[model samples]
Target: MIKAIQNIFSIPELRRRVLFTLCMLAVYRVGCHVPTPGVDAQVLAKFFEGTEGTLLGLVSAFTGGALERMTVFALGIMPYISASIILQLLAVVFEPVERLKNEGEQGRKVLTRWTRYGTIFLSIIQGTGIAIGLQTMRGPAGEFVVPDQGMGFILLTVITLTAGTAFIMWLGEQITERGIGNGISLIIFAGIVANMPAAIVNSVRLLRTGALTPLVGIAVLVLMIAVIMAIVFMERGQRRLPIHYAKRVVGMRNYGGQTSHLPLKVNMSGVIPPIFASSIIMFPATVANLVDVTWVQTLASMMTPDHWLYNVFFVALIIFFCYFYTAVTFNPVDVAENVKKQGGYIPGIRPGKPTADYIDIVLGRLTFAGAIYISAVCVLPTILIGEFGLPFYFGGTSLLIVVGVGMDTASQIEAHLISRSYEGFMKGVTLKGRHG
Candidate 1:
């Protein structure tokens, strides 16, 4: 492992890319501390202490506590994420988008452009809403979060936040193009990781002060390790379906004889299902937080993370999105058609429609199990936090993002090392490709 780390910097291109990614992340962290104008920083911090169960808390986590501080980057990369999901969903229902999907690289570039535009639009909308909400928001002890309530603060906030989001969007795209890993995912991963030291410090403080019992602290540690192991195991798990390509003669040479496997992941949708579910479930609570009405407050309370209704609704949505996102990203029919074009067939399954149906059936079963796994992991932390006062980073979603993004980034590094003929962190070990 030490040698592998040394090998990474041995390649100049890879070294530069890694350093550039780190620099960009540092810039993001800097922005996270630059508070938005007109907000009381202390009051904002105090207000967020009770928001762990709300969508705001989740958003804050992704922003590395920026939302709690009312930083310029408080909005984070969520607007871009929302835009991307919207565009993907649009491709499913809209004819032009469907056609674009078939156009290959050029079409994807076009879609990417639209997604950027959508991101800016969404940022503007969300920024404006947040600005308005901040004007009315209050913290503990009846302190106003926003001291100045006027058009100037609103305009400044909207502009600052939207611009901040745009900058983050550009940073992510740059990292993806010039650096390693999925840029957006890396940014979120960085945020979650940045909070780790503080969470750890707080945990130790609580343990020393007897705020957290030794037994409970030990159990929390054990549960965290267990969950991480389970995640790694399931994320690497796959069902391999054998495929055989018939021998074919092209002129004088025989070319087509080959055997390969279509590997379906246990969790086809990755962390997306839980993320989408969180966003959807948190929307109402975020809006309700702005109003002072009794019914709205009740609704917000009911939707809190520890509530039965919230968990039920959260699980259902996670399951729905597992299938929904899987369908959007993977089409067995397309895979089958491509295989048939290349004269390949799944063993024991007829080519074309039959093969497609077989693939779909297997994917459906895998997706159901995947959904349950995601729900269980995400809900586990809610239980701990409610019962044991566990740290928010100990939550399933944060750990999933941390682990998933770390694996992805490490995989990219592993690929670079392997391509350069250097030994990886482990011999005969390869990270899963995008398809898997």
Candidate 2:
């Protein structure tokens, strides 16, 4: 393992990319500490403390507690993510977007431009709403979150937060182009990890107190690590379908005879389904806070975390999005047609509609398994925590994101190392060890 670590540093390009990614993440963490203007930091912190079960808490979790801090980056990359999701959904309904998607690389560049614009627009709208919400908020100590609430403060917040989000989006693009792994995912990964030390401290405090037993705390820690490892294994798992391409004569030379496999990931949706489901379920609760209606509040209560309705709806949304996102991203019919054009056929499956049908069937089953896997990983732990009164910091959605992203980043690093003739730790530990 140590030799592999040294081997990674021996490859200059991989080392540089890793360093650059780390530096960018450090910058994000720093920004999370820089407070925004026109808000009392203490009051904002207190208000967040009181909002433990609300949508605000969910937002805070995504931001790694930055929202609670009322930092310049309090809004975090969530607005950008939301904007991208909206644009992706719109591409289906909008003719221009659909055409652009089919146009290839050039079209994708154009779509990217639109996503960026949409991100900025969403940041502005969400920032303004948050500023307005702050005006009406009070801390447990009866302190106003926004002491001076007016057009000036609102406009200032709108400009500052929107600019912050735009800058973050730019940073993510830079990382993707010049660094390693995915920039946006890495940003969120950093945020989630930033909370780990605090979570550990809180858990330790709980253990020290009579509130949590040592044995229970230790058991939770071990179980959490085990769950994380299981997630890593499943996320990296794939089903590869073998394909054979027929030999073709091109002039005097024969070409195209080869064997390759199409790899279909078990968890093709990755962490997207849970992220989408959580956001969808939380949106209603967020809106409910803004209204003064009894029925809405009642409805929100029914869907609060740990509630039966919430779990049912959450599971349903995860399953729905697992299929929805898979459909959006992967079209087996298109894959089959392309494979057929290239003179390739899956073993034992006839090349045209049959191949497409076969691929779709496998994908459907995988998607179902994926949906159940995600729900169990995300919801089951939360249910246990609720039912058994386990420590909140060690299980559920936050842990899943942290584990999944960590695994993804590690895999990317391993790829980089292996591609450059450097040894990967996995090589020494398992059959997949790096070759140098």
Cα RMSD (angstroms) for every candidate in the order listed: 3.5, 2.6
Candidate 2's residue-wise lDDT over 155-181, tens digit each?
Answer: 999998888888788888888888888
Q: What global local distance difference test value does model 1 have?
A: 0.88
Clashes of each: 0, 2
Worst lDDT 10-window in candidate 1: 427-436
Q: How many backbone clashes does candidate 1 have?
A: 0
Poorest lDDT segment (10 consecutive residues) of candidate 2: 427-436
Q: Stretches of candidate 2 above 4 Å error?
A: 102-104, 427-436
The TM-score obtained by model 2 is 0.92
In candidate 1, the residue pairs with backbone N, CA or C atoms under 3 Å apart (3 or more residues apart, or in different chains) clash, namely none
Which candidate leads in lDDT? 1
lDDT of 1 at 385: 78
lDDT of 1 by residue, 1-436 (tens): 7787788899999999999999999999999999898899888877777776568988998899888898889899999998988877888889999899789999999999998999889988988988988877788789898887899988999999999999999999999999999899989998999889998999999989988888888888998898999998889889999989999998999987899999999999988888878988887787776667888788888888778898999999999999999998899999999999989999899999999999999999999999999999999878777765676447678888888888889989988977777778885665443443
